[model samples]
Target: MAPTLLSSPLQGFTDFRFRNAFQHYFGGIDTFYAPYIRLNGQLKIKQSYQNDLQLENNSTLNVIPQVMTNDPDEFLFVVKYVQSLGYKELNWNLGCPYPMVTKSGMGSGLICNPTRINEVLHKAHNESDIVVSMKMRMGYENATEILDAFPILDKYPLKNIAIHARIGKQLYNGPVDLDAFEKCISGTKHKLYYNGDITSLESFKKIQNRFPTIDHFMIGRGLIADPFLPNMIKNDTKAYPKNRWEIFSEFHDRIYQQYDEYLSGPTPIKMKMLGFWEFFSQSFPNPQKIVKAIKKASSPKKYQETVASILKNV
Candidate 1:
């Protein structure tokens, strides 16, 4: 029942490096949206940020670069910048619901001010020479605000849309508000994409049953929790102990090895492996014991041994 897989943006987590690593071994995600590029006043693209999005890199695959700003001019600036890299489309961030972004009149904060979004979208289209799309939440402060936003977005011929199934204030805290999502879907006239807590195949089926029209699904935590998610979904695979450990190790060891090479210092590797454990914990044969040793590992050498020990158990 599920549609194609999309890798949702998870700010600190789904940067280009993470996306590439995940895709190399686990080929479930059909597309990956790079983390939003937070632009300041400068018209110049920072060296570090540009490096993160270099098109020459083979791992870029289906990566789409995201730009975060409320200014119409700034949006145009990024469009030209991304166009230079041969990208055919641009996705705007209107659904970010954090207080910091909202206070600045960006992200989900713009949902409350439909006129402003309309003004920016209109001008951005006039100036932009590339296909532009949008990613939004139901609303920032209230779901009704989307009503104000819909009339404007309906005017633009976007490539498509990706919407998180919640409002800004909710911020991935509780269950996704499906009722609100249905309302937004009904009110708008644009192609829609579903983005939210699709953590497993079971969850995906429920979405398929509810919304028979959906052709794309954007997943964040579910893919992170299980690297083999997309592969299993595509093949309709069940957990088989025979091939499970091999696939899991190939995914785990590849990423861990890369992190070890690039990140120096004791805590970098530790935090990364620990961060992975949040989802990796689900795959361990004995979750408690593996996680316990991983937590106790202090030095690089000790960390290496502990991770090896855990993977062996898997």
Candidate 2:
């Protein structure tokens, strides 16, 4: 059977504009998980998050709303908010590995405290009818931490637990622990979706062949690094289309125009695209050279010319 591919949420990159453009140009993702809606001490959701989850904005895609919080009240508030927006499922984020979030007892930090995890889950399940799912790292300090939490997680009727296969402290570096992930298979009653290091077709096949039971795979930075990856993986081909650069150029322009119109100054848009190219550069012949060219393009016109020149090489 063909496996299901999911686009994992990256906070600054995978917004509605990017999602829409990606789906239109390269199609393979079965669903997209919107970046987590983080509420400050207040119960209110940010306008940017609001815009991302709006039904009209996501009409063409299957999107699951996500939230990052350790507080029961905050979890419940986000639950009601997404339910109001007509989303049936809310994915809880326990996998973010940043210092700011982890220091606050949220994200991967919450994984160690299963009592708090239970508390948040308790309120969300009891107070709302919305379905609950989870996105988590194995743990913050060590891989075994999730093993301890799984008993508590087993108590809830979660949609599934998506494990990123690395501890929070690793922070996207190091190899994903297949042995640790293998242990996770028997750790919970809920379904498990694999997420981590699925950058190419060969890497994906290694994971699939190892865990024949896992059907769902989530692609995060890998998706941005190579947008055609999901579709290629779906079709099970290593060859690029004849017009690979043309399709990518069109996709890039579509997003650049949308972001340029939305962001006020030339600087913000430059930084925004720069963030994307950090990953996008990897797909090119020389990542450092491509990134250097993008970085040197100081103004909007210069940026456009630089992008054109870069694609012209292809």
Tell me the lDDT of candidate 1.
0.80
Q: Which stretches of candidate 2 lie above 4 Å from their native place?
A: none
In model 1, the clashing pairs are: 95-137, 96-108
Candidate 1 at residue 65, lDDT?
84
Query: lDDT values of the candidates?
Result: 0.80, 0.95
Q: TM-score of predicted model 2?
A: 0.99
Model 1 regions lying over 4 Å from their true place: 285-292
Superposition error at 64 for model 2 (Å): 0.4
Give the winner by TM-score: 2
What's model 1's TM-score? Answer: 0.92
- How big is the positional error of residue 265 in model 1, measured in Å on the Cα after superposition? 2.0
Clashes of each: 2, 0
